[model samples]
Target chain A: MGKVVILGDKAINDGVSAHEEQVSNLDALHGLVNEDLKAVNRVILERMESPVALISQLAGHIIASGGKRLRPMLTLSTAKMCGYTGRRHIDLAACVEFIHTATLLHDDVVDESDLRRGNATANAVWGNKPSVLVGDFLFSRAFQLSVADGSLQVLDILANTSATLAEGEVMQLVTSNDTETSEDAYLEVITAKTAALFASACRLGGLVAERPSQEQDALASFGLNLGIAYQLVDDALDYSAAEKDLGKSIGDDFRDGKITLPVLLAFRRGSLQEREFWKRTMENGEQNENDFSLALNLITKHNSLDDSFDRARHYGSVAKDALGLFKDGPEKHALQDVVNFCINRAH
Target chain B: MGKVVILGDKAINDGVSAHEEQVSNLDALHGLVNEDLKAVNRVILERMESPVALISQLAGHIIASGGKRLRPMLTLSTAKMCGYTGRRHIDLAACVEFIHTATLLHDDVVDESDLRRGNATANAVWGNKPSVLVGDFLFSRAFQLSVADGSLQVLDILANTSATLAEGEVMQLVTSNDTETSEDAYLEVITAKTAALFASACRLGGLVAERPSQEQDALASFGLNLGIAYQLVDDALDYSAAEKDLGKSIGDDFRDGKITLPVLLAFRRGSLQEREFWKRTMENGEQNENDFSLALNLITKHNSLDDSFDRARHYGSVAKDALGLFKDGPEKHALQDVVNFCINRAH
Candidate 1:
């Protein structure tokens, strides 16, 4: 029997060189999936048009803002890996992107965020009302695409994922600004908010290819772990990355008092003074000019950034293991590279 | 062959007595559909519960705020009138109510209006973030119910209605504060925003009952015209009704600078001085303390309120004519009475 080899601590602990290799791998994967990605982009642009000029203008602004297109890439690459030869994956990939964009619009409104991906958010430019309504339009448009695809299973998964996404957002709202939030509670939030869609997108690959249930479940597991790892890296990067590199200002999570994983780890390892500072700033909203620098010092002192990355590496390994059933191919290698890229991106 | 009788100028000219008769007819129709409505109410309350207390609290506030459950009633009554015997209609009716409530939540956020149905809006009570998110939850939940019903036709109609509703809202946003918006433009907005759902709800009745497509189209036409009439009466009431009677303050449309049919009529009939007044207030949004009363005087002088109701009555007659294909029964009469009630309810 062929044994599945999972990336270990040594692979991740190699640090800068390892991260560079993963970045190059991601670039190669993007090149491999370039044609399918272009089709998905075409689908996205075609679906966003409406007789109402504001909708097209607002939706076009966000859709064209140029995020990594990672979610749709997951859908496209996974479907191709699973031997999906038909055109449905193109539409489904676009549907996944629409769902992501719709959430971003609403998320900006909910977060009252001004800038995203180094640009003014739709809410910031068009005002909250249009952002909220247009977000809804995109969401409806996503479902319209799902129905046109004529897959009850896809509709079921997308519909359930949407509800979970909303529920997860509400869960985050309930847990926001509460310094006492537990790791498990934080995990629950990320699972529902981020991982659910990822899992669904990956599952659609096996589902459309008519793979066995076991294989579909494996794809879903791979996606869920990858999503968790990706979000963990994102939380860690909030404290460690430069403003230009991260595409937004650092300490936004701090300003918003969001209770992310690194904060939780740092808080657990914090000294009495540091803990008190977190309570005052995060819980009581008593932030000041030097607080962000102080926060970095406390996190660095506790090695919380490294610890958070380690946790992400653990999930990344699990994601890698879940792909054991799939045979070797360019598509499979690209998906595996995606897992590594997600874990090492912050470096 | 029995000829279909359509209401005309003489019926509307009867005025108060005709309005009073319509109210009594609506009361009787409500009495007839009470049981199905109760079941739908139960479904709404049941579905609104969530582990997140704020979701249930916020959703329950709006769901129980006691607006006339008119949309659900349309679904239930039409389904029964079309000889539907299954429980799917009950769930579908609940789904329709959910879609309506979801829109109301989003609409309140968009309008930034504090009061709805004589109570604070969910956005007003819980803030806009929760309202926007919870509205999404309800919309998702509506789709969940549609999926559970296992009818692709129902899903198609509801999904399309949702997209059209969002498009209509965006159209309204574009046209807000623009005094030059044409009557055709106004009708287009109302048709997509309000009438599409009504048409869908009544069509669900035929779909669930497995009625012929011709009969379904008739039912849809009935609902479309009724919805147009209902919205016209509502717009006129914003100017002409007392606050206590209307359950909302007068001049809301004026304050928001929404270009409704009454304003359009008044603008068309106004002299140069009156036109300038509208341009200053409605277009430039430069309103003073006496502007609402001035606007009302202009509308009254131009007989715009009466003309708007006349327009409403015209649609009501079309709604009645569409129902002529259905056999005479309590369901049919109640539906016809609903058309009259929609037109005459402003009194």
Candidate 2:
């Protein structure tokens, strides 16, 4: 396990040679928390049902669409690592997934997205109205589960996280189509929109286990940094990864005029001609058949993908360090490997 | 006050001629809870603010658009009528209005409405994405307030109501564009989507006042009945009211193919030609400019409008009767007059 940690750090520094050894598969991690994950899946399936057939159909479409249930896995894994042996973590984990799924449903509508996780989005399949309404239903169900857990602390974390998530989304909307968006502004958006839920999900582990505040904060930091790294890799992968690996088309952000970190980095470092090219394609929404390939060339020429990957690795290291307080165990080892998995997956 | 009760019943039986004398104004009722309503408004304005400019702008545009704050007023009036006093009711009342406003924001997007309260809808002005995101923000804020109020019962009621609201919306979607939608199905939609919030809002008053179960149930009954009456009038008014009076263009539901009570009643009673008209205009979405007036004529010819009003009156009577447990006072009288106001306003 210790050698695995060194191999993870070495792969980050050396770049791609040790791919098989460094990139940890989720299978082992899932095996550790498989029981709780199944329970969480059951709760998700049970709660998604409604007397209104459209709701279950729309919600079931998205929930069953199989993007790795990463957020809930975080909750279940962290809970087990913190010595939480009870069933409350199962429900809480389901709540985390619900919040994540609700946002995805709305995000697809907001982004006017056609496909998600390699499947037609709810908005694409059923249209926008059911998507919006069922998203609201999933959100309410998430809160109901939080309340049923009967923890004010849990409720506070989730309520605040929900608000932050919305705020992050609004920030992204404001920042979209603007090439002048700053890295700091981008970080703020990702932290609020993505990392806040991750933080809350991990904190739920320590919260339910009655761990000390220090332990809870450590867990939150672990999830927060990991989430940031995960999103950074995702943003980078949008410009570079194969469609099958990404579960969606490459260059989606570019086509949609979304100003992600890769674009921001490449735009910052671009020559004057390259900047104008970005301005034409992104800001003015002008594009030709070859615009996507040209954008990729600009990103690669500027080495923005490597720069983004490096930043992701830094956050990944922080995430790994945050788990140092936990004693060595299978759960802790699996969680540490998750940080490796996040960063190395792009390789 | 006693004469007003008989006037309400007679107005229901005799129809529009007695409207001027029978229908009570809301000014007196608003006056009864004026201070609390003011406090609720303050909370609303304060909470709508966010560091994100778009959130406040979109939320403020809708929140300040001047719909009668009737739902919040119910919370205030019921709490006062229940013989209790506290500042908590003010926050809870604001929470009710937030929930209502949040739904309206999403509702306009789902229904593709351009006008609300005689002003452009938030969706119409800012586009659908902002409307959807801000609606989610306001919903989260409402739950934040509910959690702050620290009442498990309040949380339970609100959490359940939010889910039911979404469920109701999905039900409407499922039943939309289908002229065969049953009266019973329409009732279920209205009950869950519209009446459930009213019930929760009114029940909040008793819950906060620590009133007995009977009083709480009565308040819930009062609100449920009033909400039914209110929505029925709204459904009827879509065919009959002027744009200025309703604060939205008439025939919106007709254009959207929404199957409200009047449509159901008229469809059931229509001749084969009339039924064909409904099927073409509503189910087939083949609406012409003159179709609205023609539908109105068909509704009037069949007395479907009057019959729907009669059903609304029945609910108004139930709402009025629910106040029997309360000792008569200004608060009680104002509430009873609200029932009159609801029934008579359709004229």
Best of the candidates, DockQ: 2
Model 1 superposed RMSD (Cα): 6.1
TM-score (2 decimals) of chain A in model 1? 0.92
Scored against the true structure, residue A324 in model 1 reaches a CA lDDT of 96
- The alpha-carbon lDDT assigned to residue B229 of candidate 1 equals 91
- DockQ of candidate 2 is 0.80
Q: Which candidate is the best by lDDT?
A: 2
Classified by CAPRI criteria, candidate 1 counts as medium
Candidate 1: list runs displaced more than 4 Å: A1-21, A241-248, B1-22, B241-248
Candidates' chain B TM-scores in the order shown: 0.92, 0.92
Give the per-residue lDDT of model 2 (tens digit) for A1-347. 00122332443211212335544456557878888888888999999999888898889999987767888888899989988888899999999999999999999999999988667889999999999999999999999999999888888889899999999999999999999899999999999999899899999988999999999999999999999998888888788744324333688899989999889999999889889999999999998999999898888888888899999999999999999999999989899888878787654
The digit string of per-residue lDDT tens for model 1 on A155-248 reads 9999999999988999899899898899999999988889899998899988899999999999999999999998888777778744224244
